[model samples]
Target: MARLTAREALSYGMFGNAAMLQNALDGKANISLASRSLPEITRQLRDAIAKRTVSAEGYPEKVGQPAISTELLPWALFEEFESLAVDHTGETVFLPPGAPQNIPRWKNVTFDAKEILELWPIANQQIDAWMNADFANNPLKKRKDRISDCTRAIPCTFATATAAFNRSPSKKRSRGQRATNRP
Candidate 1:
């Protein structure tokens, strides 16, 4: 919900992209967040970005990535901008977003290659369960959601599951969901 409008605030920046990526990796959605209270969470996210302090409703204090990684951010205020990027070798290759080639340089890389390489293994070390025990009573997760299917039998490919997420989500959680779902 905060991401839906973050583009304007973030200025199409490579730094902003890195910031948002870290936010996703570090923060989990509050099961209690919904339309009735979305504005508060959006304010919290915006405030966190602006002030570098967090007080989100469902998270423990200081749980998510609050500081942006300056080294990972493109220098020259420039870096190869891409919708998708991969670390292929010594060079970082990226598919540019409709711009002419103007490679950005990272002047002060504080971390070494070993740290970057280790990140992949760390990310893959263990899979975290999406729906924790708190979601045991959620009608959506229990009956309407397709999430459980991915855990059993054959896994659904991205293409196969793309349509599953294409459906319009409800504007708000009904009273039934709110009374029961807590995390």
Candidate 2:
């Protein structure tokens, strides 16, 4: 049995009269009246509010719960029939004999191979800097410092190479082709 303030009671649509509202706030009268009327109301209100709240369930305790823990079948191990039978539009895409009802969507995203090849030297330099920092025990040079240095170095390398990539290749003439002055 809890008594709510007038403001709280008003928020819950308990009473309209100013004097009655004051009495509720003062904890004198309307204590029993409000509680009796709004006993199950708060539960319904909470349920409604909870539906709108964004929630994640991977914290230590929540992760340990059977409801939160999920098992997934690897796409590589999926049989041809199972792949064909999966509902592509639904939330869960894959299901083996006894697999969980829902599985997070796994995407096979790929980077531009040529772009990656171009960045290889930059990656090597960053790795070397990181190793050197670790060996030297440099307190100021953190992982992010190495990244920042690499980012700074990349623009200079990119500027020099920009012209080469941007230049349109000259079209070569075929063996049979010859220059003819025809306008």
Candidate 3:
């Protein structure tokens, strides 16, 4: 936790992540209060989200023994279901499932995940450079680096993104065509 914002609490951050984090934080838009507590809250929140039941299989023994409860059919018990059920969660937050939408939202569009993986090294280099570069912390961009925030940020380098875009096969398609992907 020290590596993350130097506090026991976690910050989902603002501006870009504000809405999504707001949706995730339990109390609607009152997310700012989450940065003031312990990690146990997060664990409890995850349990609350995935917890289905605490049911007893048998009666307690006669000698002041307690009944042990079992978690029945909770989503976390199954690895595959966890992906479907939980979009995101933490101790202090659980983002509800979002509305499903078309992946490309356009006909004749597709993605090759392998190709993206191949380009990851270049993307990583750009990201490292961006992190090590001065001005990443500035509220305003430096004049020389201000072609656009894309040039100063990770994964949005014009040359690399444009090259990847151009590498993809795009074309005018007939109305009958459908988009597909391998990602």
Candidate 4:
């Protein structure tokens, strides 16, 4: 977003491209380019940059190369920025008045019941292959085993199937973890 805006701003004779890139690196120019609520995150980033603790001073102004790199930001500072970015998801939080409410966001879509039933064997085959190939090395084996169990226990409630498919069954009892829909 900042790069596009910086290019546009450069086209309008606002500032030099190198200076714009530097400002973006410093987190000073991109504040307004981001959502209103995210300005605080940008501000915090700028504060960190100004402290010289997360400096990217030697970056060159190459045309195809990126000016601002997150690699320069330390893990601690990155975590701090991430914590401040908790409120990152809101459809209309930063939009101006009269702006469109829905701008087409990505969502986790689930397969329909028919699709799930049809794909069960393929999924089970993949799981079996994984289990045979690198079962001991992969930490996902436990969850995959649960999914294998869930695949056999078809004609079950979507919630129960999903719970079994997604999670490794715990030794301790939990209310929602019970396979009430199991035949």
Which candidate comes out best when scored by TM-score? 4
Worst 10 contiguous positions by lDDT, candidate 3: 1-10
Per-residue lDDT over 1-183 for candidate 4, one digit per residue giving the tens place of the 0 to 100 score: 112221222211222122333455567776343222334433343344345433321222345666453223233433333232111121112222233333222111111223223222223333333333432344343544544554443234445545544443233234456533322
How much lDDT does each candidate structure score? Answer: 0.28, 0.31, 0.30, 0.32
Put down candidate 2 lDDT per residue, 54-100, tens digits, no spaces. Answer: 11111122333443442332333233223211121112223334555
Please report how far candidate 2 places residue 65 from its true position, in Å: 28
TM-score of each: 0.18, 0.18, 0.19, 0.20
TM-score of 2: 0.18
> What is the alpha-carbon lDDT for the whole of candidate 1?
0.28
**Residue 2 lDDT, candidate 2, scale 0-100:** 35
Clashes of each: 1, 0, 1, 0
Once fitted onto the true fold, the runs of candidate 4 whose alpha carbons sit more than 4 angstroms away are 1-36, 62-172, 175-178, 181-183
TM-score of candidate 1 on Cα atoms, chains taken together: 0.18
Task: List model 3 lDDT by residue over 52-158, tens digit each.
Answer: 32111112222454535422233343222222221122111122443333211111111122222222223433433343343334423333343344343333456
